[model samples]
Target chain A: MILTEMMMKVTPIKNGTVIDHISAGQALNVLKILGIYHTTDATISVLMNVTSRNLGKKDIVKVEMRELEVGEVNKIALIAPGATINIIRDYEVAEKYAVDMPDLIVGVMRCPNHNCISNTDEPIKSQFLVKNKNPVVLRCLYCEQTITENIADYLI
Target chain B: MFEKRHVLSMREFSREEIDAVLAMADTLEPYAYGGNCNSLTGKILALLFFEPSTRTRMSFETAMMRMGGKTLNLGPAEGSAIAKGESLADTIRVIGCYADALVIRHPKEGSAQLASEFSPVPVLNAGDGAGHHPTQTLLDLYTIRKESHLDELSITLLGDLKYGRTVHSLAYALALYGAEITLVSPPSLRMPDQIKADLEAKGTTVRETGDLNEVIEEIDVLYVTRIQRERFPDPREYQKVARSYKITTDLLKKVKDDLIIMHPLPRVDEIDPEVDGTKHAVYFRQSFYGVPVRMALLKMLIGGDDID
Candidate 1:
């Protein structure tokens, strides 16, 4: 297919991380997860609506000179659970694995509850439990308020 | 087991812990009845009520005072440093330094948890927006235990289940004791589907319906909550479901003879005046149980063995 052929033509990164198989149309959310708002010193490439063998359409994010952190991966897993993380070194894939969400998340994202202690003026850090991983159901440990529908909106 | 701990949600308590609280409440009943008891003498409690509450606030104060303990009350937090743009953290930190325990009621859902983070002492959730109310749940469980044992009884929760924090917490607590729950509300004000799934996951039988008359006969406890006019974004929607489910003495004809009716009071026009005189009306007594339950909670949290 034309889309698959074009996907193969993109240049490979020498030393960086490649987030592959992001559910189509979530590349911007992935960028937010990586904290890549403005132009950074490192090279960054984001491909949206790319054709995939498994998924009909997908998005990919490539960042040079930086590997993904567990907290970042956790945020990504909430939005794109099936996405794979590929670390590239010297123009070859060095490590490849799917993001594994942690059972408990601390201070990564703010609680969706506006009244949550985390959102208050207090020094309380947000804490969440992964109630479900596949669709990313997060329950606030303090308030017990569940966030399933808008996982992206609450992502820090 | 709950010594110097933060009571934030009903989810934090297990069946055994709930049983323990109820047992302690049973032990402290005499003090709740104005008997002389000094369980928490010299212990100081800080009452931080950021919201307006007559029952919860007074009950906590009474619980401490009856047990020979004192309170530092910050009436209507809007007047505190919070009004002058101080963060909830700063205010809690200041109070935490002064008191052995903090009782906070805020307009925000997670405010108690936030206060617990800053306070060095134990933090008790009075009510946080629409979030969990652990103390209220304790009183509710106590009421349930008193009216008609918590186990093996069918419960019908009437009216606005959508925004009723009491109903949400009560349902979760009741499930721990294997109570069959039936939720009755207008279609527009139904209980959230997520709560239904959570109850089912915990192995509780939950039935949802719009008609209360159809399920009234099978119910042993009818817990009614008012349909707040503010919950609706559009006032027109509120007008439609407002009068859909009011409890009257005439409606009690279809219910079981031993059925117990309860409400988290400051109720507005939901239960008819005639029903207040019926034997089923245990809501006032339920409100009375708050004193003993809270006294039990203070004892558990304050960490003293002897109740003088």
Candidate 2:
């Protein structure tokens, strides 16, 4: 029996989200951003360092029975700015669009600034302004401290 | 233009807005010293100083009093409900009810920004730990404009640039007025690279030097800040940096004839007592400018159209 490249790779999900064209080596971070760890009940397929025509190499995360939310999509844009989100319904692509980085991000990640007001017991969520998109840099709105390194670790 | 506005950071103000505030400060100058003004007559200002301050606290109080506005001070953290484990948010919310404006200075960076969110009225940041002291920057600009011209002026910012919140805000502001800046500091306490980059990105001319003598003869303003012993991890390193940066009468001899030396006072040994008597010393006058600058701010925040 001849196995097609599609079968050799990830099988189609009847319904859910396919995050494609994620910058290579960022699938785990994408899962972490999506709050999908080993405890998740949803069937997940992570294809890392897969060859792509647009991107020489990319990572893809496919989740069964779950569609991406606005906040999740925004979080993904911070880590993988060039990623594309595809909504899959009944084994067919229902909608597809590339993730657009938000001008302002609220409550999505904890500010790395320990002295930031967002880190205090105040009834406020962490807020950041996206200063740069590619190799994302977020400036904390409270402390004015910029977060440029290891952004995934700051995920809420 | 400033009614009900939050003066959180110098970055929030444009050049035009800064000019407007300074212009208002000029009009309010007479009221700051001895003259009576009741513009803010029944208004109440709440001052929450989680950190100890001399100039900032007193000037804010004087500013409120001069405008006939009452002030409520949160005196010390140990004496307040903050020591009883009440969050800053609750404190701000409670005080916001009693005051027309809230002015906060906290040891934690962004504390004022936090209070502004919960505060029902306008919030003014007196100082936040190594974060922003917008009013200080405003007063510094006021002093600069009073003593020296801001147009194409050459200024040198000396001492703890990295941790000195005043210099951080002042640099951006001075740059906004199109002044050329020279930064002098020990290598360890150099201005944060990001701030220098931001200044340069805005087409401001910024130069760096380790020795004050390198640019002292050429500059018009010399802004000095203490090499804070608390900011250094090592005592010996702090001592070495502090010793090397003292402003002396000997150093003043080489400065430009009209060069004005300014320091946000409660200064340590950074400036010699002998230098204070010289025409160059404007630190005391600089401290005095704080009153009118803050008065203009308070009047603008709560006093409404009566100021114009």
Candidate 3:
């Protein structure tokens, strides 16, 4: 059996973060904010609006030759809180990252409130509290409004 | 001296800060009822309104005057600097020079941000087009707390969420206090994306439905809003959905006996006049609070111990 580029098995990179379980539609949104969507020496694969068990249907992305920093990983966490990041070395799991809910996330997630503290170019980041369990929620500490799940992964 | 502040939206205040403002408003309410307070002594508030606003513009001016502050009213747009293509920035700069603070209402969105950039004084946003009326939110919050006795009550937001800037600002204020918000509008006039996500993410437990009958009884406060024809994309479409949801007295049968109905007025048929007779209607009293609540805001933003 032959596999196309979309269907082919993706080989993991050494010492880079592998972000998995994005809600298919938000993969590119995550990539744009993380700056991993385009690369010169790296390969970026994205599967969008795909079928999955966890999400009833979900999407996946495997980036080769690029390492993701905590700040960049936060971009994904803002939008897709359910997303999981796995650190790979020699195609072996080195560490795992389940979106860490920061007690006060500043300049990370864009406050769902447009008039939020972060919206003004006023050199201040939005702060939020991780208020719940099971499905973690980010509450804007300043405005006390909720940052949407779609915008959650970005709270760096 | 009263300093300048930009109050484009209610999102500027926190739950506690809002409460503080309300407390101050309670103090101002007495002054309004008895007579003028005139505590500001010798400050000035510049009223730069391109659009005609009866309540808000007058309220702020009155608030400042009662506090012993002077006001510069930019009466109408016909002869105002804006008629001659004088930019908002330029006008704000002009106003910022003489006044200690600015209270502005322009017909354009984001005009307040632009004004705040140039205005030397703190720019209190009166109402920037269909954008926001933060002072109104403060009063609305004050009214809800007084009548409902709970900030986190079951709130039903009816009518035009798309352009009802009051509702947009109020929703976030309510969300901060942990209110369960149900946005009821025709599909065409639903709440904006950022706000919807804001409510859901903050554990607001929001319900977005086109129909109001299903949830009218469950609500503690039925927040009615008028559909602004100016905010519509297609006039034909506006005609179809603008009046789709109306809160009549008969509809209150499903509501709690103590349910409070509110509207940031200049209302159309969205709320039947019959509803006004019932205790459920707080829109009038809510509208009345504009003077004192804004007085409290002007005092706080201008630097006063009255904030708490």
Candidate 4:
């Protein structure tokens, strides 16, 4: 058997997070969850639809000088459940682990229910119970409304 | 089990807890009529109704007064700080400081659950849009227990099942007691698929049909809910369904001799006045049961001792 060396599309970051194995075409959504737009201060690179032996085709996001927060990582799990976060320090993998979906998600995403209290100007963050992981189903803790599709569309 | 707990939804309750509330309600029945029970004497209940209410607001107030407790009313949304654009959290916090418990009715779904998060005291959901009205369900259960038997109850829930919050909670609660539910509604106004599925999953016998005449004679209770004009997106659609299921004396002739009819009233024309004279009309009595059921809830939630 012949194993060909794979080339890295995006250069490794010295001190930041490298989110890899994001579901194909979800790189932008991951960025949206991270609140990283053109005005974002963190230097970032997003590689979309990259070939891989594991995922066939995947997306990768590298952010310079910023480690992902626990809330951000949990939100990423909704959109890219198979994704892994590698903390890069001095161009070396410092910490690497797959995102674990939280049983109770808090302050991470907006509930789609228009009449939900979380949608009002009240001082309360949205909450959801993770009912399913693969297809990413969420049940709002307050209204009991379920979100089964387009999970990223509700990211806070 | 209910002490200092928020009564938000019927889904949160178990059969034992529901039975406990019903048992407690039985003990508090005397005070509901005309008696002095100072169980909740020192406890001040705050009534925060962002929506218009007749029975619920008055029921809570009557429950508190009957128990020798005072109530603070927020009146209408037009007159309250809510009109000044204060958030529900702030309103709850401010009222929580003054009251021992808060009973809220809002136009938005899940408002009481949201208020519970901010309230220092326990929050009781009176009604929240088309969401759960657990107390109403409790009172309905209490009425059923008094007028009929919850054991092996065969109930036919008629009228607007889709948007009727009372029927939704009642159906779920009845399912807990293993009631055989026959749902009668127009196709567009039928019980929600999710609720029907949940009921069936719980091993409750559920039958759906458009005709109430087929099931009227066999059922133990007929729970009717008004098809609200506000719940419909179109007035014409509302008019079409609103007139589809009126209870008349002619229909009552076919029912079982002991069968009782109930509605969560402020009813508009769904029940003919002629049927009000029939033995089957227990709705007026059903309305009265709200007082005792709420009294039991107040006593249980606010650390009030057993009156007797």
Best by TM-score: 4
Tens-digit lDDT string for candidate 3 (B163-275): 67788888888888888888888877788887799778888888889888889877899888888777677899777775567677777777888999888888887888888
Model 2 per-residue lDDT tens digits across residues B1-308: 55437888898898888888899899999988868688888899998888888778889999989888899988778988989999999999999999999999887777888888888999999878778889989999999999999898999999989888889889999888878999999998999898999999888899999999889899999999988898889999888889899999998877789999999877999999999999999999999999999988887778643752
Docking class of 1: medium
- Candidates in order, TM-scores: namely 0.87, 0.92, 0.64, 0.93
When sorted by TM-score, best at the front, the candidate numbers are 4, 2, 1, 3
Least lDDT summed over 10 consecutive residues: which range in candidate 3 chain B? B1-10
Q: lDDT values of the candidates?
A: 0.86, 0.88, 0.74, 0.88
Considering DockQ, which of the candidate structures 2 and 3 is the better prediction for this target? Answer: 2
lDDT of 4 by residue, A1-156 (tens): 544443345555789999999999999988887778659777899898988889999999999998887667867888899999999889999899998888988887898889877788878888899998877788998888899998877877
Task: Please provide, for model 4 over B1-308, each residue's C-alpha lDDT reduced to its tens digit, 9 standing for 90 to 100.
Answer: 55438899988999889999999899889989978788888889999988888889999999999999999999768888878898888999999999999999988887999899889998999988778899999999999999999999999999888888889889989998899999999887888899999999999999999988889889899998887778778898888777768888888887889999999997898999999998889999999999999988888888765574
Name the lDDT value of residue B76 in candidate 2. Answer: 71
- Once superposed on the true structure, which residue ranges of model 2 sit more than 4 Å away at CA? A1-10, A36-43, A48-57, B1-4, B230-240, B304-308
Residue A129 error for model 4, in Å? 1.5
Backbone collisions counted per model: 6, 0, 26, 0
* Candidate 1 colliding pairs: A115-B109, A115-B110, A116-B110, A117-B110, A117-B114, A122-B89
- The segments of candidate 3 whose C-alpha lies over 4 angstroms from its true place after superposition are A1-156, B1-4, B229-244, B304-308
Q: After superposition, how far is residue B198 of candidate 1 from its true place, in Å?
A: 2.9
For all predictions in the order shown, the interface RMSD in Å is: 2.0, 1.1, 7.8, 0.9
In candidate 1, what are the lDDT values of residues A1-156, reduced to their tens digit?
A: 355666576777889899999999999998887778777787888899987999999999999899887667756777888889999899889899998888887766788766566775565668898988877788897677788887777867
